[model samples]
Target: MKRIVPLFFWLFAGSVAAQSPNKSSWAPSDNSTIVRIHRVEQVKLEMPFPDGSSFKNLKLDEVMAAYHIPGLSIAIISNYKIIFSKGYGVVTPGSSRPVTPTTLFQAASVSKPITAMASMALVDKHVLMLDEDVNHFLTTWKVPSNTFTEQHPVTLRELISHRAGVNVHGFAGYNRNQSLPTLIQILDGVKPANNPPIRVTAVPGEQESYSGGGIVIEQLLLTDVTHKPFSAIMDDLVLHKLGMINSTFTQPLASQWRSKAASGTNSNGKAVPNQWFVYPEQGPAGLWTTATDLARFAIGLARACNGTPRAILSQPLAKAMVTPFNDGGAQCFHLDPINKGLFSHNGQNEGFESLLVMNWKTGNGLVLLANSDNGEYLWDILLQGVSKEFGWNYHFDQKPKEWLLMAQIVGVDAMLKYFNTQKATGLSENEAGEGDLNQMGYFYLSDGEVSKALSIFKDMVQLYPTSANAYDSLGEAYMAAGEMGAAKESYSKSLALNPQNDNAREKILQLERK
Candidate 1:
């Protein structure tokens, strides 16, 4: 086991004060407007924190200054009532249009839950199976081949929940008329989704890994099972019924909605358009909807969690969707809960930033959608507000918990999107056994303890025997310790598992020449 890093927690209360150049330092006061809304009546509905505040008005404003986001929208609900729904700033950077309830925004991967709901609706009609193998209904590509010794089956649940292990974990190309490739092409990844054929490099269900590509397989599989295009199925189950009149699946950019939609920022802080809006992996994250529609969905989630799946699905399926099957990168509804098992997901693709969370027990929830990159402040502060409404407390010391728990903790960019269309809550729920061994290894490696890191890597390898990185890292650790034989053995194991592993190949060639 890797060394346990010490984490600090406070007794109660946490806050982030805004930093305004014009205003002198302001402290929490009796008359502070930073009060949270526990359950305000007559308001429209939103909040990310879902409870109280630390006087973060200044922090939120500073975020607007930092990211150059021109607009933001939010929705919140408690006990089936709309508490607050509103937008911030201008719709476009320079345009005069003010954001409103009707101002539509592209939700990106925030659209996953909607897709999940639509699929579950079909399941309600006996047209689909939640646990069926996607390969059974496919007319085109299927999950790639791997020499997995374990009999882990890839089911529909794996695709949506992100455990399908299909390695193409992301999308950046969704052009209109992009010559949609066959499902096989998308899976093989010979070209971008619909461009050429997508080749699969790993077997499905080998481990809990993210793959937007896996989602495509599930999407096409859904259509194949229903004998209808994915969009047609969505229109029937959700879009048409929820009155999501302003939403779409495939691209045309809806030039009218462009200005109202949020834009992404470069590392140096500049706006950029979404590259994937123009790829065929639209089902994974191509749908466009507003905070209102999403809030309606969130409310619907609350209803479903409370045994009200709009009569389209069972509460069991809805609960399964929110339950973490393989830690959806904490991207689309993963959990650590800090203690309890909770459901939450954050979607921040190229040009969009969004988040939604719900208490599995209380049925309270919130969704925040920003038209720019001001997600950090907008989301955290809003959640603080949400805490007030829910009478929950914010653990400030636990700030940045999700990132702290992942392999990549800096900026969130990875093609490896986690899927868990599975109904399982997790490997086992509790803050304990639910962390990334790779991440733990990195922390140990960073601390310069090679032996310690190797121990963690060994555990990880045993857990995910098919992962080349686990063996590769173990080999590196052996090499560092001057154990040439052990290093060669580990390297051989890695190469045997993944012949394409350049690092292992290079290490082996060096040993042979020596």
Candidate 2:
């Protein structure tokens, strides 16, 4: 493990943090391509014009700072092998502990894919059937049957693909000091469980509705059938088998990996209280892993998909894992339409965000793990760089909304100018919306630019007068700027516009108290 100087000093000094030691024989002979990817900072606006001037290249460190990301790690898989992996920035804002390739970050919903893979492995072993009723395998608890499940039973296939119509889209992990819920409590959504009960709400296998609660049911199924803990089952079925040594499904994380774990940070770059949330919902949200390890998992899946002998999954099962169900989901991964072979999954926990995109057929992909709420902000920019460097056709479209990019590079004034000019030309009809401006406002607020945030939000309110969210955002900006009277007024207007705006109502109460 290596330590680096604080983020401010390191960014100002333009120094490289110590690189993780490469033990893989597949390491690239020259890292010039990786260096070039790091230097890629240009943002190209997707304008109607044929020729658009590219924004100046911003360094990765500078981008990290602007986004208030404390730490990030990336791993690139090329030709069915991990060719490059590295980490950047300090683990926690002011800490000297540098993020390393092995540093663990919560996989969040990314855990779903791994859990899905484990389930598929069971299918391959004849221990579990994909189409079998999930309740058959579950001993601890069963999905409460209702009218929705009368015609179509909730099957493992449906659960894995999120077609089970289960309620609760995601889970909010418990605080470190909070009493943890058992698997049964989480499914039943009882005391100490912060979510509602997981139950089928629609006809199973009828439509796709992403439900982490559905995955928790599969977790219990695995535990019951295997007669082992979810974490142990994952270790034996997937992680250890794939040589993902740096990954674990254990909640609260193992003590041995504590020092090696990056502390989750909020969008404003502050460390999460107690460092990170404890996700007891292991199947849906509780995998702690490194980018390199995730890349290994991706590579292993790629091998299995290609019919490699003795791979973690059988050929048919592996192919089925990526095959989109009737509802357009492939087990846990989502297929990319642009590159038909690419399957990707993104994850977000309290203060962590992660993305895994891999083309199983071509064996090319990238894993990005960040200990910040705003981590996904860097994905498109970094993906562009990777696609350019590797000549990969399966990258995110390089074109970004003009105003949003302007907000990042030129600040509120330039962003508004471009936005207004485009609006005058009627070219901003689809691009410039209440949501875009609201996002821009929050970006400014998070960066501590109160006046800039206020400008954006005020304009947003003017643009969408009837939008309660716009007024609510304006109230937030006013509150951040210490204009309590204006904030109260804005919240009042928002609450008036939409009586269900509890956020605005709460803000009014707080302001009234003040």
Candidate 3:
């Protein structure tokens, strides 16, 4: 129950350049626009309170420093053209090598959409069928069939849209020294493969459940059908066609490219061990790309959506890529209901994070890549700034959870008073949500504010008495405060509510031993 809080929440809560042959001629008249964007004030949280108070605006550098992000690269698309692309900070912390537009970063789950795009390209040809059972094409490894797959066979369409009902949400790539698993070993979840067996867990096509495991199956299917490496297939179908010269699906990234790749950094801004993890699961997470290269991919999709002839993907296929299979997801992207024509995806690896948002119809998009785990904290703020500057319709209306912010800016007593006041008024409070409050408690606990964390956890138990997670979190706070008896009692209550609370059971054992 003691979750790893995003650095932003702890602080507030207490919390590109590579061009394609189809490139547009549009160019900004001056550097003024980019400068203004960098200086754009931090987003103001629209408090529901009567006073309407907001936080002071901070510059981009200030925010980056606060979040401990080592490096960031960005590319922006407008009017179906890349109008701006640049990089800020260093490729590694304390290093003289500055991030450049061409510097590569791990694309993480953002690789999924590109992989999905490649699959669709196969569909466009006669090579693959979206509706056919994937097992038919999978010669090397087929999805292990079970009750969940008996009546509902998995299809490429379902896999691309995350409706395939497979297990294993994602993968943790191997360290440099770890022995790499063969694709077959990975599929069987055998030794050297860290994840469990990728198998059907629910009725396929019944609903959307993200399955990176399903994507690996797709990777194998492509390889089995084409009799080629997964990385080469992607290049042939998508990357080469789109002219994304700096992108690759290669794992243990080619030695020639390593010098241009940004070193991944932890939340504290320290370099990841051996600089980065090597992901062999190219379909789900393996990608080394620059912001400009990714922007080219986005622009290609946009052009295809506009029915441009000879685009990387056919018009029909491109439209299908953006069209949601369900309310939540399209082939590999999530459609934002509030932002019309917007399809987006975000990615996270061990010490890297990324985001890609595009309005396919208008050819407007943003790509953000960073080398630090704390990178996501800057996304919304930067998105808001970009949207404002570009006059785009994108809007992020959710007010950030500001309990930690209030505690930092004002005193804890005042923050608590405001919380109680808002609760008494019967108004929906942003800070009162179960997840938000739990995150706030974990933030405090991480900051070594044991008393503050205890108070927050106690309130969570009061607010949601029957919630097992709430009790589990309370138990963690009690244990952190060295109150063994109270910790055991809270753990007991948590277990009584939900016998499946493994963390609580583990804590109970640890406390008994003590």
Clashes of each: 57, 0, 9
Enumerate residue pairs that collide in model 2: none
Candidate 3: residue pairs that collide: 8-15, 9-14, 9-15, 10-14, 11-14, 11-15, 12-15, 13-404, 16-86
lDDT of 1 by residue, 349-378 (tens): 554567776665654567666665335434
Among all windows of 10 consecutive residues in model 3, the one with the lowest summed lDDT is 10-19
TM-score of each: 0.62, 0.87, 0.86
Q: Show where candidate 2 strays beyond 4 Å.
A: 1-27, 31-35, 41-55, 395-398, 401-410, 429-432, 446-449, 465-468, 479-514
User: In candidate 2, residue 313 scores what lDDT?
Assistant: 90
Residue 205, candidate 3: alpha-carbon lDDT:
95
Worst 10 residues of 1 by lDDT: 7-16
lDDT of model 3 at position 484: 90
TM-score-based ranking, best first? 2, 3, 1
What's the CA error at residue 205 for candidate 3, in Å? 1.9
- Assess candidate 2 and give its lDDT: 0.78
Q: Give per-residue CA lDDT, model 3, range 1-514, as digits (tens).
A: 8555321121121111111111212345778774555454344533343356544554455456555577788888888888887777778777768787888999999999899888988898879999999988988777888898998999999998889998888999999889999888888899899999888889999988888899999899889989999999999998998889999999989999998999988755568899999999999999999888899999999889988878888898888888876455566687877778888888889888888888987788888888887677667666766777888866665534555445544545566667767777774645356676676677567657889888888877887899899999999998889899999999999999999988889989999999
